[model samples]
Target chain A: MRLEEKFKKLKQEKKKAFISYVPFGFPEINMTGDICLTLQEAGVDAIELGIPFSDPLADGPIIQKATNWALDKGANVDLFFEEFSKFNKKLKIPIVIMSYYNPILQFGLKNFFKQMKSLDISAIIIVDLPLEESQPYIKEARKWNIDNISFITPTTSRLRVKKIIKYARGFIYYVSVTGITGPRDLSYSQLSKHIKNIKQNTEVPICVGFGIHNSNQVYRINKFSDGVIVGSEIVRFIENNYCEKNFLNKLKTHTKNIISR
Target chain B: MKIPNDKGYYGEFGGKFIPETLSACLEELEIAYAKAKKNKNFVNDVNFYLKEYAGRPTLLYSAKNLSKVLGLNIYLKREDLLHTGAHKINNALGQVFLAKFMGKKRIIAETGAGQHGVAVATVSSLLGFKCDIYMGAEDVKRQSMNVFRMKILGANVIPVVTGAKTLKDACNEAFRDWVTNVRDSYYLLGSVVGPHPYPMMVRDFQAVIGKESRTQILKKEKKLPDYLVACVGGGSNAMGLFHFFFNDTRVKFIGVEAAGFGLNSLNSASLSIGKPGVFQGANSYILQDKYGQIKNAHSIAPGLDYPGVGPEHSFYKKIKRAQYVSVNDKQAVAGFNLLSKTEGIIPALESAHAIGYLKELAKKQKNSLVVVCLSGRGDKDLDIVRNYNGIKL
Candidate 1:
């Protein structure tokens, strides 16, 4: 299935996409497949598989800890690709790889995107590759048929929003706050105003991310945005519960609670 | 000499590879910095502070004793004599003056060896702006004196407890702060690293060292020095001295990097053995694993303990305009002791790396004049030195 079809399908069903994020190799490379399967089983529309980077400037403490823990356990791109290749045919939802630019840039963009394309990865979110430096990634991603998910923050100027939506693919990641990825008490009315402002400019579906943690926030975001991207909150939970006896069960319950009923 | 090509690329190395949240802020900074360079009052303010306050035209002392010991004509650019005990105050005063110009109330920075942190704190205090410094927790423990100095200077020193607890992590935390509070706070970046305007701006602020060195060298020796040397972490002091001589084809540049254990072992020798990659916004030679996870940089001198260097340094390396070498921790400590005993100057461990390399350079030629930038004073490093040599006194 194409990346846009997922959003179209969700829109036709009058439902919002509940995209749950899990760092691909949070505990270890092998554990990621199981974690994704569990999240899928718990009823997520898509998986935002975060690749562990040494320097995640856009991340907060929770995701930073998770990334460090993942890296300490010997997480590498080859292992991630090998693991994902095993479960590629089985994945029911789209896999959007969220990573910083360095890891993939060093991995060789051509080879990395080829593997991502073969694995049927729908999109990629390079947190550090802002629009100006994104030309190289955009060119490479287009050739490989991978959707380039761009970010639109509250701070993004109106002129930039117009420029971004012109070439925007898959969905626009509407950063809910001006800060890094972590839970924050965001004003819904203000967020709604920004979201509506962005919505008016683009036909591309938008998902609100960064600090949307609870069912209440999820429910509120679903009323407007096409999807809700739950990142640091879920990563924080796994950091606390990854070693628990019933980790999968806890994750399922936790994920189910946040998805709008 | 002309670089960054309007889009800020120093030979395919530096660019504004930042986040969207900070894009407008960076663009604003770029425009403001461009104008600030042309603004007569801004230029006067920076020059005035550099002259009247930070003690510009620091002595180009001919180190005759050290020169006789190494069998080479050695000249020392005594940046250690500057206020705040390093060349860092030059950039700090300039950046904060710009912050004052732009009406920013808060000034924030990241530090490794604490020289830059102390400099920023000093300037922030002098300028009466609210100040916060992010230093690695490990650095806070090591450079405890500098930490205290920052606090007493009326700056909030925030310890960064993430990612090897060193310079890189502190930089990450500082970027997070800037990203969050970019509107109200001015990120007074410490070195010639980071994105576009930072490397260019910091170098411009610090170019006074080279500017002064050139004039002083000619008056004393009747010719430009054959070689210029300075230690490289993020390459601020190095760039400060090197950029002015870029057009002086007769002069050669050498950047000394800290080889913590050895280049083969744990080290911070980015230009020596690092691969080209992006980290902390700029594309530079970064010490990383094959999979691109940035490796922890190790150095006894906290300042040079970074895995990445300035993009401009990488450009110089690639274009063969400059050469880079490494000195081990033991060699650096040896350099520290040799300079103290021979010249009565205790060089910072970072600067000692360059001093240590002089022994190697002395072997190549005789009677050639070489200038080494003593980038900072070594008072903050006394604890580390005592511990290294097991000296009770």
Candidate 2:
């Protein structure tokens, strides 16, 4: 099924999709499964499982720390799948493993796709893998029935937008800011205009990311896009307050508060 | 002789005492570096580049006119004469060569004033590796010559529009890129900051400055300098020069951080005003608020406007091996103008911070020999100077 159709289906059911991004094997390798379970239990609609790579260019200070921790615990492709296998029980949300191309290449493409399919990853967002450079991976992802989430930055030209929107399966990641993934002021009119442009160009669901930090930004973004992603801010929250006894509940509450009407 | 704990801590300043999330990564690097350093071949390879490519053993030139003007002898550690016109090349060469030795094929780096990007790109060009440089959009605009230089060297320069669109955003972007592409790429940090290995490795590479200066001073004056002066952005050049004299209590090391307006005003004098905290990996003195959140640091010299200083420099300041001083924009400009007219050497605005304090120090101290690190040439800063001088170039 196309990601656009999936997004529309969720909306028709009056369900808002929540995509949680946490570094793979963060805090500790043992903590990975528990964090996933907590997110799944807290009613996360979808999960973007980030395989912690040492050199993450699109992340912020919080995610950087998470990547460092994950790498320190000997997290790699082997550990990634190993961790995923621990959550063998049925998950509530669609699990999408978000990673850069280097790790996948290191693991070998043929085996990687096969593992993703077996692990039941619904989608993949390979950051830095532009459409022009992603033909082989996209083909493999499609063969495995794994949806490919394409990224479109504010600086992305109109022609590039059309190409990405035409082929994107799960959704089109609209980078609200012009730069790397972090918090900044959103140009609502520009964003809405871009959304409308994408809506006009293709049928894919548009999900905005790269700086929807506070509740106000989420509420604002929720009105315009099919779904919203809060990666760095949540990562920052975890960094600041993860060890607390009520951390999971606090996260759930924060999510609820942001999406509340 | 002992490697400062696993955290790379040097007297509480260099610890990787971050949140648990990054501890593993730091440990991985620590182990890797320990092994890498032991490999004699790796040391030789990095040393080869240091000698051949970065124009190592940079000269110790006596600032003849400045000495005459101030009535005190002043010698300059000419890091400005390095391959990329700054001391940044020394570390870039070392780090990138190490990346190649580690079998990493791709390089990702961040730049503020673009000196580091230019240096990294220049090294990557020679190493035949794919290179990506993350720079703030504002920095790209301000340092367009360097942007052009990096692009010409075949490195992809990605403009980061996040945050204030300065060094901090560039750092964030670089970290994000690293998180995504860690396996096949190495993050070439611009200074002696970041996680373990980087701070130590960069300092080791840049330490040649002090090594050369110490020898030159002994040969010329038959003694060590009474005072060593250098500007601190992330404190690389300062660290390089001061590390050799660290044990020498007689040679006073004075590091001038940019006080944008003043220390009390908005500025990047992190060492003077900042409190200790864990940021970007290492525990160091950083410009932070009462809540311990990193504060925005401002400076006219783009290179000196960092929110934090190197962990080693922070430690040195705490223990009094080095004294941290702040130089404001007006003073730096005066220093720049003075050096250009008197010495015919246009030092980088970052280096001007140290120069800015020299006149006052010369006046205060009687017959004291001062060695200031001219960390970079000012060719890239000519445009900014032209604007400030109101003269068409």
Candidate 3:
């Protein structure tokens, strides 16, 4: 299914989508397929499979540890896509491969997009590839019908926001932070202003990330944007609740309560 | 041939394992470093600063009586004579100068022993750029003198409180700041570890040690010393002295790591006991577990307590051009006292590791010439050692 359609489906229920993110094959690569299946079964609106890169400056220690574990397990583009390809048969959730441009450059962007498309990845968010420098990749990815998502932050001026809006497709990732992603208490006033600014600048669905950790942030996030992305917390959750079959069931019930409210 | 562009990988030791957001910053730094290293103007400008500002060609004084007592010919490279009393000034001057040339308006670095912090503050003071230094809370408390010096020099010393409150935590906090403010800020890493261009770039800047040592040692002895010794924390000073001798089979390089109580006790000897693993985005020997989790590194000397060594040191050790030994805190303190009274030079606690090994080398090898890198002065360490020694000023 198209990436936007998944968000649309969530909007039909008048609920903000829960986009779960995890470093693909973290802790160990062997557990990736299981995690993907678990998230899919848990009714996650979409999934961003974090392709672990060696130098992830935007992540905190928790995510950094997750990436390190994934990298240590020999996680790379080839292996990531190889493992991701296994999910094409069983998982119905739209998978977006999240990574930095260095790995893409190393893998060659054209080839990387091609591989992403071939592996059935519906979207991608290159965190460092701002709209100004994304024309070539966007154009190429467009040809394959893969969604090229863009991001905006509190620091982004309206002029820059318009540029991001112009290039944005699939959905817009509205980062609630003016800083790197991590665990922090969100200032409701600041987050509301950023959300309002993004809504004014873009026509696409907006999903806020970078500080949404628990059910409280998830409920608060619904007032600002169309969806919420919880990355570090979900990784933390999986790490803390490793090997428990009821983990997914509990998370699903918790997420359902947050969104339903 | 072009050097590798990867910022934090050293024979599988250094690479960027940071968030996706900072990859572009690391890439930009990699490009800037490559361009600067190749530029003749940059090279000549850095050379001029080394000569004029830092007082290059610091004397290689022969410790005749001390050598006689130890039964070995020990020579001091005397980096303590440099403007900042440590070799950190070499890298700070090189990088801060590069930042100015690159049009960066701010300088940021992390300090453990505070030598690098003061060195960075010195360069920033001279260059007219805003400077920020992240030091561990523990280090700030211990090295309060250097903390005062940095603040007096107009650099903000931010105390980092995370993960044992030490050098590694300070580095993490600095990197966190760099990712956010990298557009106008240049991260002047104090050592030769971290990702790619850093190890190579720092080694290039401090390579002046090897360059000057080559000319000085040859002029004085008409030959190289049998062994070159320096203390290793992140291994910049040792690498600086050893880089020139890497290809020279005639000279042997020795790196002394702090053993705390001893290697048998808690200490930070990543090179001595660590296996190949990745941390903070570089590949080299690191203190890590079987699952690749970074373990806590211990050492009484805050400067030598780091969990990893520089990439070049790892490379040199792999090729067998360099050897590393661990010296305990008790031995290092004794070495510090011996050097101070015997030679009238107050070596930094970190540099005392080199002296500790020198004492052992003097007993084992008779009439052998050795060049010991006096990497820093001990003025900042006086308070810590005074309390440890139970002596009033």
Model 1: per-residue Cα lDDT over B1-393, one tens digit each? 478678788998988778889888888898899888899999999889899999988999999999999998999999999998999999999999999988899998999999999999999999899999999999999999999999999999999999899999999999999989988999999999998889999999999999999999999999999999999999999999998899998899999999999989999999999999999889999999999999999999999999999999999999999999999999999999999999999999999999999999988977779999999999999999999999997
TM-score, per-candidate, Cα-based: 0.98, 0.64, 0.72
Number of clashes found in candidate 3: 26
Higher-scoring candidate on lDDT, 1 or 2: 1
| Candidate order by decreasing DockQ | 1, 3, 2
Candidate 2: regions farther than 4 A off: A1-261, B1-3, B17-25
lDDT tens string, model 2, A42-101?
665677788865445566666766776777687788878877888746565677778765
Predictions' DockQ, in order: 0.82, 0.06, 0.13
CA lDDT for candidate 1: 0.91
- The CA lDDT at B57 in model 2 is 82
Residue-wise lDDT of candidate 3 within A1-261, one digit each (tens)? 677788777778777788888888786787788777777766778888888765465677788788877876788777777777766778788888888765665576788878877777879997656554467788888888888888876656666677778878888887776456777788888878877867876679988888778878888878878888888877887777776777667656655554455
- The full ranking of all candidates by lDDT, starting with the best, is 1, 3, 2
Pick by TM-score: which candidate is best?
A: 1
lDDT score of residue A66 within candidate 1: 86
Residues B1-393 of candidate 3 have per-residue lDDT tens digits of 223334343443455544434545666777887788789988888889888999997888999877877888888989999998899999998998789778899998999999999999999999898999999999999999999999999999999866667898888788888867757788999999876568888888888888788888889899988999999989999989988776689898889998886666678888898766556656578775443445667776788878888877887778777888888888888888989988888899999989978878866778898998999999999987898899985
Q: List clash counts for every candidate, in order.
A: 0, 22, 26
Q: Model 3 off-target regions past 4 Å?
A: A1-17, A21-43, A46-57, A60-179, A183-228, A232-261, B1-16, B38-41
